[model samples]
Target: MTVRPILETHSPSSDPSWWGAILLGAVFILAGLIVLGDVVAATVISAFIIGIVLLVAGASEVFQSFSAPHWRGFLLRLLVGLLYAVCGLMLVSNPAAASVALTLVFALALIASGVVRIVQAVEYWQWFGWLLLVSGIVGIAAGLVILSKWPVSGLWVLGLVVGIDLLLHGFWWITLGAGLRRDNRAITA
Candidate 1:
């Protein structure tokens, strides 16, 4: 087949569904905002899911350790497995409490990691030093915000963050879809 024939066959004008992408993006933005509006519940659900995942991972680890007793790290694996299982069980038993505790840990880790980032940025001064510094500052601010609210903030932090991410992604998708549609129009023109 000639190149012209192939081009015509695969042309975007042959498919007029580009508008659907914009609609999908709008829906995503709406969903993200809705989640942000009810972040507490979302956070709780997220924690619950994590707890369940931890439980399964822990159980699997324990089972695998026993199944492969000949392995050199069998004892270590067993210990880790027991630890995971215990933590998972605890989280599963009280998801609300788990949420608060997990959030607290996350906040503390963020603070520590932010400090590390700041140090790295100062010392390394790579091409992305500014980006690192800005990210570090934001991380610290976010960590402090979470710490200030503590248990209360824990209930909604994860969900709020996720909602924001989704909202941002939704905007990107919409922009991308619009760009694609514009390109299609130009091609047809």
Candidate 2:
């Protein structure tokens, strides 16, 4: 049996992209730290940003609806666009409320996903089922914790999650950069 590299043809030699990854990792880590420092503010800001994005997406969809060839499709797209726009306006108008609502939705999603994963884990128990089980348990625990705190949790959970995500993402990028650098060295030598 033989194992093949996924990108056998691509060489890491002479590529300076690793440095960029490292730089990005550092920035992400810094941003994570900053967000963690003021989670409430971070949550509000994130909600506002999401609202703006939704608004833009809604506008784009509405514009595209005009190009739809059929009346049914046009009506569907227009309706979706209007929904998005309305939701975006609501979010923008009250980011704190939006954060609370979104947090509740997130908690529910986590619990539902955890339950689904647990069921799937039973089926896959013979092969890496333990990992899935652990993940599912963690998800359930996290959701429970968030729900226990409810509205209070909403203010900080999103920001804390974002910060943690950024930190992990930074670490991943840094590790990737280091690996690339090492591979480059090996290839050059």
Candidate 3:
């Protein structure tokens, strides 16, 4: 027996976007589950997907940087985008090696982000700065742990992250879709 979420007659979920969300959520959940089943394969696949996504994002960023006139930090953005594309291409070419490399990069990035966040918290203490500080602490700790694990962590981290992310996204979409459908029903009623 399939249980359905409660919804009003004219629910917002009746909208096409709601439907899309449902589909997206379902797909993510399915994919996440699949990946969780075989972490090694999932890690490799995740690396490849990340590479492709980064390449596309980089290309888009580079194009936009040049398309704009008198844009501030245009060169910086362009360079960053190019770097993303190159790194992505490298990931695509050798996903296994890339996964390991990416893990190291990820750990470093987390630590850097944590430090930056802590600095921001210090600068902006009045606006939930403590929260930021805590987050930064957590980030630093997590990064350190990952770094400590090194290669052993690399084989599983990417897949685990991807799986969790997908599951969360899937849940979000499913909830959104169910809500929308309920709203749609209410509206029509």
Better of 1 and 3 by TM-score: 1
Considering lDDT, where higher is better, how would the candidates rank from best to worst? 2, 3, 1
Which runs of model 1 end up more than 4 angstroms from their true locations? 1-31, 105-144, 180-189
Model 2 lDDT-worst window of ten = 180-189
Query: What Cα-based lDDT does every candidate model obtain?
Result: 0.72, 0.76, 0.75
Give the best candidate by lDDT. Answer: 2
| Cα-lDDT of candidate 2 | 0.76
Off by over 4 Å in 2: 1-13, 67-72, 105-144, 184-189
What TM-score would every model get versus the actual structure?
0.61, 0.67, 0.50
Best by TM-score: 2
Q: What is the lDDT of residue 132 in candidate 2?
A: 53
Q: Give the poorly placed runs of model 3, Cα more than 4 Å off.
A: 1-14, 49-93, 105-148, 184-189
- TM-score for candidate 3: 0.50
Residues 44-114 of candidate 1: C-alpha lDDT, one tens digit per residue: 77777878888889899999999999989998999898888889888778877788898888788777877
Question: Compared with the true structure, what per-residue lDDT tens digits does model 3 show for residues 122-182?
Answer: 8755434565576577667768887999988887876765565456556656765666566
